[model samples]
Each structure stands twice: as C-alpha cells, then as structure tokens.
Target: MTIQTVAKQLTRTTKYRLNNGHHIPVAGFGVYLLPPAETFDLVYEALLQGYRHIDSAVIYGNQKEAAQAIAQFVKDHENVSREDIWFTTKIWNVDHGYDETKKAVEKIALEVKESIEYVDLILVHSPLTNKEKRLGTWKALSEFNHNPNNGVLQVRSIGVSNYGKKHIEEILAIDGPVVVPAINQLELHPWLPRTELREYLTKKGIVIEAYSPLTQGRHLNDPELLELEHKYKIPKAEILLKWSYLQGFVVLAKTSKKERIKLNFEVLPEGQGTNDPLQEGSNLGKIDLDPNILDALDKPDSHLVFTWGGADPTEYED
Candidate 1:
C-alpha cells in the first residue's frame, strides 16, 4: 500500500482482529514499570496523544493508576468512551493456580475500580510457572472467557505473555481449548525478532503484540539502526516502530515523556512526501523506511531481551 493509503488507514482506525472477533488498536502504550506516583499522568498523556490501547499487568502494580487515567480521559473527552479504549492486564506468577488466577483477575478489576465488563483483555503473564499451575491458570481464564453468566469479572479476551512454542503446545494439548488465545505478547524488536515463535503463533491465527519494540532504547546507538535512521531521515524510535508495524505485529511503545508519547503515535503524517529511496511516488507519509533496510533489521543476531530478567519458559519444571 502507498504511504498515504497506510497513513489514512492508520488514522481511520488501525486495528487487529483477534481470534475471538474482537478488535485491538494496532498501536498501544505500555505501562510496564511506571511508578505509581506517575502512572496516572503518563497514561493520561498517552491517551491525549491518540493511544487507544493501554497495556498493564498485575506484576506492574499500576493497574489502579492506569485505569483511573483511562476513566478520567474518557470523562474529559466527549467523543471517547470506555469501549473506545482497549485495556489489558495480566495474572502474576504467584497467582498461577485455577483459584488464584480467578482471584487475581477479580483483584485487578477491583483495583481498577471499574466493572469487569469494561476491562477489554486479560493475560497469563508468563509460562515459567510449573506445567500444572500454568494449565490450571489457563483453565481459570477459559472459564471466565466462555462463561455466559459470569458475574463482575467479564474478561472479553484471554492471552499469554512470554509463552514459547512448547508452552503453546502444552496449552493446546488439552482435550479442547475452551478459549483459544487471541494474542501472545512478547519482547519483540528488530534485535531479537523471535521469528520462530511469531511464525508458530501466526499459523494458529494468534496475533503477536510486540513489547519493547524499541529494544528498550538499546538499539538507539546500534550501527545498523543508526544507519537506517540517517538514511530515512526519521528518528531511530520511529524506524523501530515502523519495522514492527510492517511486520504485522501490534506494537506497544512505552514512554513517560508526553512529547515522546505523542511522537511514537505520529508514525506518519497525512499526505507527506519523503526522500526515502524506497518511495516510488510523491506521497510517502510516515512509512518511508526502505524495504532493504527492514530486511537488514530482521537479520538474525544474538538474543537481547532487555527487560523481565531473562525469564525463559523452557527452564520451568514441576
């Protein structure tokens, strides 16, 4: 598609259709490590910057602040409503059993101070917990997802984060998955693309939500990335964001700075032209990065997961 076409579509509504038939905004703001004192302000700023999707987790311990920010943003903006925003939270590692997982979800809803009906998505934070506990957690999430008369905690969708191919196989090994995962949130970026896992999930119709799409600022100084930035005349961060978007992954770009938040969402301007060598027309808009550059960005490299303390599911055992 032409850059102008892409820009128009992004502005009109860039969304990914999940397996459950629900739609999530293609771009989201993550509140992974934001301090409780600043989570509300940062999330509120992000909403003003056109971020319709906000990602949080029970482990992050900022659900209340993020939720309050969303609530306040909706109250202030007449055109926006609770349904317009996509809110995602997760069950922590400590809460890995069936009962514990259910209670964790309820606790998140209570902390957010919103009806469970308003929470858009919930996830099993990680698969590093034992197989039994992991499966039990999935069972709890499935119950909430498939139950028609579920009270207060009506999770619209359930998914996993940091789950590998083996972890997914285990989930599917059940007689029949009550609710198929709609998405898998992972630490994805050009440096550590997780190509195998992405392909595995893609074949199953599960969307990939890319966290640390910017590599947590580590790629800012990389020679290859800097070359792309200079070649495209776009900021390094924008380059990374576009790379993830072009790969058909939902990108979660997090920043506490208001200006950076706005810049992250400004992937492209409407009807703008670029000097990018990849452009064949007058209007290049925001997607000016060259295809060859993207190819180089995807080249295999040493694994570099910047956050989460190197937790791997393969090492977990009962």
Candidate 2:
C-alpha cells in the first residue's frame, strides 16, 4: 500500500504519557543496526512520518546519527523544538549506579546534538546481581531527578529494566518514597503473556513497555500466529506489534525502511480480534510454556534474539 494510505489508517497516537507525568509516543521508531551516517536520514524520515518518539542507546552505537537527524529536523522545521520530541535511551549494565547513571545521562545528552540537555527517559538497562551497587545506581538516578541545577545532565524520569516485583518492592519498601520507576521494559508476546506482571504493575500505577512483542520473528512461524496473519490480511510482524498494543503496553518497534515502519504503526481497533486471539491454547492463563522459552528461540536453529535491555518484568505470583 501507498504511504498515503498507511498514514490515513494511523490510529490514535501510540504515544502515552507515563505515570511520572512524562509522555512517550505510543509507537516509537528505532535504529538498532544502521550506522551513525545512515541513521540520521532514517530517523528524520520517521519523525516526518508522525513518529514523535525516538528510541536510541549508547550501545546501539548510532546515537550520534540519531541525534543529528533530530537536530536537522528541528532546524528544517522552525516550529519544531526539541521539546516536541520524546527521546529514550538506556544506561548500559556497566554504568549502573548513582554516579555512572548520572554520567550516562550526561553522555547521551552530548550526542543528542540539539540544544536540549536531556532525554525524556533513561533506564537502568537490566537487573544487576550486585545489590549494593544497584542501589547506588538508583540513588544516583534519584539525585538526578531531585536536582534542579543539573540541566542536560538531568533526566526527566528514571526507572529500571527487566526488574521484577521483588526488585521494585526492595527499592520502594525503603525509607521514604523513592523515584518511582515509570515503566518496566520487558519481552511480551501473545504466546508469552505477562498477565501477573501487568496486574502487579497496574496496581502500582506503573506502565509496562513491551520490547520483543514479535518475539524477534520467533513467533512468526507459530502455527497459531501464522493462521491469524493470513486471516487478518496483515503482515505477521504487524500482528505481533498490534498484539502488544491490545495488552495496553507502550511498544517500541524498529525499522529503517519507511514502508516497514509505517506498517508497524498501523494498529487495529481494540477488541478487533485481528490476530484471532480466540484461538485455543493462546490464552496466557492456560499455556504452560516454559518461561525460558526465549533461550530455546535463540537455539542454533532459531533466529537472532532481539532485545533492547531489561528494566524489570515480574512474573510475581498474584
């Protein structure tokens, strides 16, 4: 289909304002593989196509280009300021801790190019076994939040990744309220639903961000998903992204191609059953799939495992 047709069907803003009072576009575009040079135009096109939120990372190795693209977009469009953009990046595992988290933000801000000092959200890439160190890192994030003088070094919202209920409770149960983690980035898909985790976070008023909703193409070959893909007349990838949408999570999907990105953004109306979710054995409440099915997917025969980073997703028993 034509770009015009795709744009026409683009439904509600995939972006969502998080519980922390910060906003994120519902469907943020990403550039995980493009070199810095190529990323500039890809990001520019994504923003021009109505993607306000951009997802990048230091490890992804293209923040320089991504930032350049955002800068050029603002320069070309006089009315679009840096505030018009929602940017997200993660702190690498090596940088978790109070001081490192702060410096990480400082580093990302430098790459963002535009005059804006800080990105919208910065998360601890994943759970760290080093308990005391992780606490220090969170402490650093809190310092960033409470500091008014740290412009550009200041991050609007701070949170964790691949975290579980235990991890959050550990922090929150501490003396006085701490920085509430705004979103928990996790792997989510119809085949591997996070029902308990979602329910727990919902109670805490935290948003769940889904990363590998398409299971990095692992689910594409599933008998159930394939059947629904054919029935909906939508590509399987779109079906995967949409399934995450139906679960009420902010989904980040990546594509350098305008066509693929557009298709990823086309969401079906809620309750439309576009993926035929009603198929037997698809329900999370029933399926007994191993939680570590991801490792199996990464087996030699399976495709590459697509992952950004973990904040925290708790399968905490309700």
lDDT of each: 0.77, 0.64
TM-score of each: 0.88, 0.78
Candidate 2 matches the true fold with a TM-score of 0.78
Cα lDDT, model 2, residue 146 = 76
Which RMSD values do the candidates have, in order? Answer: 5.0, 9.0
The digit string of per-residue lDDT tens for model 2 on 1-318 reads 221222222244534546767766666776767677778888898888767778777788887777778878888999888888877777777887677767777778777735445667777766754666678778887777777467756678877777777777877866777888887877666655656766787778777777767776655887656666566465678656655555556677877677776566554331111111111112122111222322222222322333433222342222
Weakest ten-residue segment in model 1 by summed lDDT? 272-281
Shift in Å, residue 207, candidate 1: 0.3
The number of residue pairs in model 2 that clash at the backbone is 18
- Flag regions of model 1 displaced more than 4 Å: 1-12, 113-117, 268-286, 311-318
How close to the true structure is residue 142 of candidate 1, measured as C-alpha lDDT?
A: 90
